[model samples]
Target: MGFLGFLRRSRHERTGYELYGAAVAAARDPYFYTGLGVPDTLDGRFDLVGLHAFLVIRRLQGLPEPGPALAQALFDAMFNDMDVNLREMGVGDLAVGKKVRAMWEAFHGRAAAYQAAMKAGDSGALAAALERNVWRGTPAGAAAAELARIALAQDTHLARQDLATLARGAVAFLPAARAVA
Candidate 1:
């Protein structure tokens, strides 16, 4: 993280950090864990973050200019955070890579499922995906429905956002007003 750090200091990189932070914040909202019964475990938190990040990265898809680069930066920030978390959890340095790879696979699979649902404009499909990935088949009751509503709304909201704002590392997430505990 010395001189090599200079390579990571672009606007896209900065924007990625900002967006990822926003995603983490959204995931950490108490409603998701308490109301939605998201387990409040490490796997639960990762699923929430992965869900949120997928929304943002999906928004950046197919956009010209800084969109792709910013998305890639956001991805890097996520994996970097993952690396730090694993280390902090007492994972030996040698085993971190394998664990992270597993995480990457899970995230990638989730993203693919979400993308297909979004492309099909199918709420049921999205909810099914969430049921498997986020809820782990336990069923979150009304809160699960609320999360699906939130994701669709957030996706629409993010789509309406100006690229200039996103390029500056600025993202505004909609409130979870539709869902209550």
Candidate 2:
């Protein structure tokens, strides 16, 4: 690519990283772990990140042109972070790719489930999917429903945001603490 093309690509990558960072921050909210009863383990954290990423990506998919590109960047940014995290956690070099691929499949499946549930306006389906994935098919009391509510709220909030703002990597998630109430 030429200079301008390289610059544009770099800018998109930077925005993708920023957006992914926002999703991670939202996923790490104390309310989700402490107040809502989400497990505090690594897998739990991954599920939360996947949830937040799905919210952003779902909205991005509906826009024109640069929307798809930005969505791809966001996906790339997320997997890149996962790859780095796995390495940091001392996964062997060869194992990292396999692990990342498994994670990729998990994220895709979860995202698809979420998209379908929300599109059909089936909160119960969303909750069930959350329970199965987030709670590992174990009982979670009201936590799964609460999480479903929060995810719906965040999705609505994201849907209203302008593409331009999102393209600039300026995305905001509704506070999970308030969503629980």
Candidate 3:
């Protein structure tokens, strides 16, 4: 199906298993993996998680079909890798932990809402949700929003391209942070 058509499909009407399957398939794809820069080893762990999260978001958005087992594997890998990377990045303290957790919760909550709207076949709602979750009021969010707009303008067929660009921007933030440090 086309991207808009795919987005309009309901997750509940489908099945967690089916969604999970798609995620898994997407996760295993070389193109997806390379786009996210998944390492052969567990080193640079946080980068891995960031990449996995990027991929997982795409998967949830209906980009692939690998199955639940692979999806679970990717999720576990991402969580473990992120924890290690966060500590190394100096987010080891409780305060930072709480903040990061809050950000994560907020992002995921919005993502779920976006998925629901997409499933319901509401293009307007889906676009609005993506704007709110990924764009809405922050510099980073604004950039993402602009990218999303460009992607949507192409008829939603550019999800992978848009996601790659988003991932690159996100990864770029780390280097910029390091330079400042």
Candidate 4:
């Protein structure tokens, strides 16, 4: 690759890392688990991060050039972070790879389900998906409606961004007030 190619790749990687940071930050908001009834557990947190990442990446897939590359890099970054997190949590090195691999597959499946629900263009679809995935078959209880509303709102927020801005992989999540948070 030439110098310009190198430069572009660097920029793409940076954007991906930035987008990953944004996704994780949004996922870390206490509202989802504390207020929205998402279980405050490892799987729940990973699902939330994957959800936000998918939201932005779905938008990225529509772009022409670096968008797809950046989208992929962002996905990698999420898993890379997860790998490090596992290590920090004292997961054995040999087992960490297996765990991360499982997480990647699970996240991919979740992303597909979420994208399909979002594409259905109804809050009901998203609600049902969340109720199934996040709540794990049981009803989401009082937080179901609010969580659904936020997902819909976040989707709209993503839709409103210009393709160029989105290509930069910098997504801003809309913050909603919650009774618990």
Candidate 5:
């Protein structure tokens, strides 16, 4: 099947398990690994990030009312993975670390508000949350933007230049993107 066909068929699954399985399979295969330049080692955190990204996309597509705690957990997972990559690359001393942390906290706060709005069926609140601090200029913002694009299929709304810059940064730190793609 074509890529779009796979996505459509996968979306039809009634349970998250099927979607999660497909996502994990995709993440493990060389197709995604080569595209993202992720290492084959089980210890590589990028693989986990990729899997979580797929899971988040599936959950959002299913429109399941994931509680605030669940959302927070996912956010924390992604943030932690990015932090690990940053530290390994010796970016811990850069101001980018502080900026990235602040951006993550802001994103988490907005995401919680968004989840509450979703549960309340409050469109206004959702819109407001989306509008506020959706993209801060930091590594976390780039990761969040990538996740948002993956989850929402709304890539056009993200800052492309910033995303590219962040992707380059990640590639430099991870040393896999250059080799993968």
Candidate 6:
């Protein structure tokens, strides 16, 4: 790759990082924990991030050429951040890769389940998956239902957003209060 190619690639990676940051911000909204009863633990946080990231990836998949490439960049950005986070948390160097790999598999599993449920327009299925993963099968159906609703709303909102703006790494998620309401 030439200088321009390198610059172009870096630009996409930066955009991906920006987009991932936005997803993390959305996931950190207090409404999820206080209002919806999602646990305020590391696994819960990871689940929220994975959920939001999956939503963005799903939207990106529906776009054209650059869409797929951007989606790959986004995925790469997410895992890279996870790796950094593990190291920062004092996970040993040798264990970090294994931990990250487990997280990667977990993310893919949850994403697939969510995608299938959403594609079928089955809120119950979505809630079931959320309850299982986010609540660890502790029977949080009502809370999971609320989360499922928010996820559906987010998906609809993202679908209508201008693709060009999203491609530039600017995403606006629905307001937490409004979404939870």
Candidate 3 lDDT at 52 equals 31
Which should have the higher TM-score, number 3 or number 4? Answer: 4
Candidate 3 on 1-181: residue-level lDDT in tens?
6768978543333333333333333334442223323333433232223323444444434433333333344444444445556788777568656755764565466556655654575656654555444334323343333333332332233233433332222211112112112
Residue 69, candidate 3: how far off, in angstroms? 2.1
Which ten-residue region of model 5 has the weakest summed lDDT? 167-176
Q: Relative to the unseen true structure, what is the C-alpha lDDT of residue 23 in candidate 1, on a scale of 0 to 100?
A: 91
lDDT of candidates 1 onward, in order: 0.85, 0.91, 0.40, 0.79, 0.39, 0.91
Tens-digit lDDT track for model 6 on 70-142?
7778899999999999999999999999999999999999999999999999999999999999998998978
Which ten contiguous residues of candidate 3 have the minimum total lDDT? Answer: 171-180
Per-residue accuracy of model 2 over 1-181 as CA lDDT, tens digit each: 6767866564489888988999999999999989878899999999999999989998999999688788888999999999999999999999999999999999999999998999999999999999999988988768898899999999988989989999999999989988646
**Runs in model 5 lying further than 4 Å from the true structure:** 1-73, 85-90, 94-100, 135-181
State the lDDT of candidate 1 residue by residue for 17-120, as single tens digits: 89899999988888777767877999889998998899999888767878888888999889989999999999999999999999999999999998998899
Q: Model 1, 49: alpha-carbon shift in Å?
A: 0.7
Residues 27-143, model 5: lDDT tens digits = 454532344333445333333434334334423433334422233344444555557656776775576579567746654565566556545756555444433433222223333
lDDT of 4 by residue, 1-181 (tens): 6867776555567778889999889888887877677888887888788888888788778667777887888887888789999999999999999999999898888877777777777667777777777777788855766776787777777778876786666688876553223
On a 0 to 1 TM-score scale, where does candidate 1 land against the true structure? Answer: 0.91
Q: After superposition, how far is residue 63 of candidate 6 from its true place, in Å?
A: 0.5
TM-score of every prediction relative to native: 0.91, 0.93, 0.41, 0.84, 0.33, 0.93
**Pairs that collide, model 6:** none
2 or 3, which is superior by TM-score?
2
**What's the C-alpha lDDT at position 154 in model 3?**
27
